[model samples]
Target chain A: MANITNDAAKPERLQLLRVLGPAHVWALGVGIVLVGEYMGWNFAVGKGGMIAGLVACWVAGLLYTCVAMIDSEVTSTVAAAGGQYAQAKHIVGPLMAFNVGLFLVMAYTMLEAANAITVGFLLDTVAGMTGHSGLHQQPFIVLAIMFLAWLNYRGVLATLTFNLVIVAVAFTAICVLFFAIQFGASNVPLDFSAVTEEPLPYGWLGIVASLHFGLWYYLGIEGTCQAAEEVRSPARSLPYGTMAGIMTLLIAATLTWYMCSGLIPWEYLGQAGTPLFDAARVTGNVWLMVLLFIGTIFATLASANGCINDASRAWFSMGRDRYLPSWFGAVHPVYRTPYRSIVFLVPIALIFALGAPLDQVVTFSILSGLLGYTFMTFNMVMFRRKWPLDTIKRGYVHPFHPLPTIILLILCSSAFFAVFLGYGTQLIAMMCFYIIASLWFHFRRYQYVRRGDQFTMPWPRPQGY
Target chain B: MAYEPKKQGLAAQIFDVVTLLVLTVGALYVPLYMGLAGAAKTPNPIENPTWEALGQNAAEQRQWEALGITDPASVNDMITARFDYSFSWAALIIMIVSVVGYFVLVVRLSDREYREVLDERFGSKRKGG
Candidate 1:
């Protein structure tokens, strides 16, 4: 039998724990919320599907909580840079890990696209204010993507702080609204009666459609897990930070929905290019609105930067393992950052940025996450015996034991696949074909791993010993 | 043996709490400043019996006169929107408490933990390298 482990390859240098503290870590959580959880979908959805829209976010929140726990466990022990790919590789066989590595490129690249497009959406409003329309037109979005790409390519990461400064600043915009609510009574106390799903916005396909649009809201939480290797002390900070980030975003998102439901109503929001900004006019405070706008700009830039870092790291790992071009693994000698791979990611992301502002991109991103998450959940189950607390020194004992893990796998996987069933009939068929092709390519890459030269991947089993 | 943990000073703790509250209120500004909520409640509809009786009167031709005319010019005039409404005292105080509390606590913490953080960050990065 062919050896399955990557033992023969020289090990990469171990990462030193940088002096990142609670606040820095906390900022990452806030970044995830502002970027991932704070993208405006209330205005994007049609009126009647309001009930489903609300429920979808709630489900997403619970899912986020579950992913955080499991991710903390996986990341606390594993290196942070490679993140889910590293964790998945540990528990599952190498073939699945190979599949995960490829998809991460797809996943992260698309997320960068979503961020650019989202900023483009907000740009439309900013343009109108300056007495110009279509300023956020696709050409500008392209320029923004190129600028972002240049930032990544130009050796900016080495000196960059991990603190998501812009997102955090905008996160403060919520205080102004809270004050207003206390100052004046509500016009309506959340009349769920007016809620409708009749025309159902996008019709029977709305839920799946929204799921795609919705997935963008949860994009960058994965970055925190990837930072596990560089964390001060994973035992305390990792678990708390991951859970805290998810809960914080969940609370903020639910509150945003609850407050906005009757205030702006769905129709006006759906049609309004700058829905939130429009609402700001009612508050009668230009300074407050200015703060929000500036905060949003900060939010996008920080999130984009974080995404580039995480995705490039994933590219670095796969390249080092020989699944991708080895050139991508080249780290800057002085800076210790993956300069080349990050540059490569920019163009891939730009393709999606220039694509029409279809909600389908969000669906594709979430579907990929779910597909990868399935492998992650299954791997944790498979490796339960090997990494049991007795074996691993700092093992995380999940609060509700096997049951929650099992439930998480079932629900999260089902929801992920649910979208495919809903709208991915053709795409799923194509994906199934490509996955088969991927497996074939895997085996073909390693003739030694297959018996009788049929075909094979270097799917070596990893022995912890 | 594990090192003995240093508890944050009362003043520092106060600052931390205040800062966190500031952050919370600050974030909530997104919803507030956007006018997605906090609509001024409509005062109860003016339900005077005379006004109701005036609508039913066959003297509807003189309904404009029959109704109180004390504020005719004001009623007919185009009302301008005022953006500079006085903020409620409660709104003003809660905000002040949170912001002031944050500054005070931060000042206290600076006096206490500044040495430790500096030693850990810039000092250690320089020394260890």
Candidate 2:
């Protein structure tokens, strides 16, 4: 065990392969998020009607645009596996870093669990439809989690390449659905009347409430930064991949909203389980339905697979920094994956998938993501304050400095209010949970953490000496 | 071990472990015990309900009912339920102040410590004479 620990501490062993390019990073980010365009985002419509939903989508897009710009800037320079966690460590302090790491782990794990559960249920539904009943969801859930984990543990290139293909297929399905409906291929004509009639059924306050659900449109896009260490050229690839991912999501989101709202009534669209699939079904075309069904499944699987890659990386980074046990930091000798961290998270995710209520699981994941975004606002501010522009060679410098930071803060605070308006208790509970975890880390974990080793980037001293 | 971890007394380690366990449970369980977790209790079905099953067709609704969703309309209502819209100003203000205040404090403290590092590494900056 001691020799293994010594071996794990070697710099060569600790390093992740720099095989990933911009496309892999794009696949990682978009693979995790494209699931949103297929479902979940419509919940905003349920909260605030059609107009509020559209407004929320655009507003949320603005919030994430700020996030992507800030993330691109810091991630290009930091170029680490922990993403925002690494940014917080270098820019803020240990406590904030620990919290950010926890946020990433919890956010991605819960999301992975949610995706696995969805996959299990999807397969079970298929079974029931085909005259088979009592196909228990647990084995399928376990299988999905295990399959994805095994894929991740094998290698990064294969995993992300697979993600790229399925994500492309799912994204193409959305585009096809949009164009087919646009060309009047659907027997039913698209209806724009719903937009004008009862635009804001519940008033502007509903917009505030809807903002919480709006996040589903682009929740995990910031996850692109987790691939910083793996990218061939962190400065160039991280920014390019992240920006491209966000643009793709933006177009897909707009197309999804347009197609679903035009095809289905607002009342039903607001509460749809699978809005895109339903839209295809409404088109009265068998092939469209089949294609959309495949799209939904692929999106779910891709999300789970991406979540595994990200959560393990964040956990592995934390372990490497001594924020968690060093046992989890070990990279596989051959596969070059954070094999232990990948395996450790499997049971945690499986437990949540099997036992917890789905809505509660989703709420936990969303709140954790919200906390990460809030941290990015301060992280960007401090990063610029410490490093300045000319002090370091930034791979990509965000155009506006404090403007994006300020906008992100306001939007983040508004999202906090939106969560408060709806899920007041879970919001507070999540805060309390993080607070307790923070206390644990500050009091215990910080001592074991080495300050010198934490700042591993090849950058000069921060300014203002 | 080439890298030695910081040594702590057994009592302190145990205390930290116990505190983490108890507080973590309290943080997660109290709200759940208070019935505070049920913001949206919709069935997260993998497939979308058909139009006929959404009470658009009487026979299909019956079939759905037999399949276990006794009342599709209630489920619809639950899924489409909007927030009350009115939030307590006190809660919102407190939340904003707490978050922004925390960020401000972290930034200020981190700034001081960071400068201390810069001073150690680059030598203390001499003021212009």
Estimated TM-score for each candidate: 0.67, 0.87
Clashing pairs in 2: none
DockQ, per model, reads 0.01, 0.23
Task: Please list the residue runs of candidate 2 whose C-alpha ends up more than 4 Å from where it truly belongs after superposition.
Answer: A1-12, A124-135, B1-30, B40-82, B101-129
Candidate 2 lDDT score at position A263 = 71
Candidate 1 ranges beyond 4 A from true positions: A1-19, A43-48, A136-139, A146-163, A185-193, A196-214, A268-275, A281-284, A425-430, A433-437, A446-465, B1-129
Interface RMSD values for all candidates: 26.1, 5.6
Q: What's the TM for model 2?
A: 0.87
What docking grade does candidate 1 earn? Answer: incorrect
Docking class of 2: incorrect
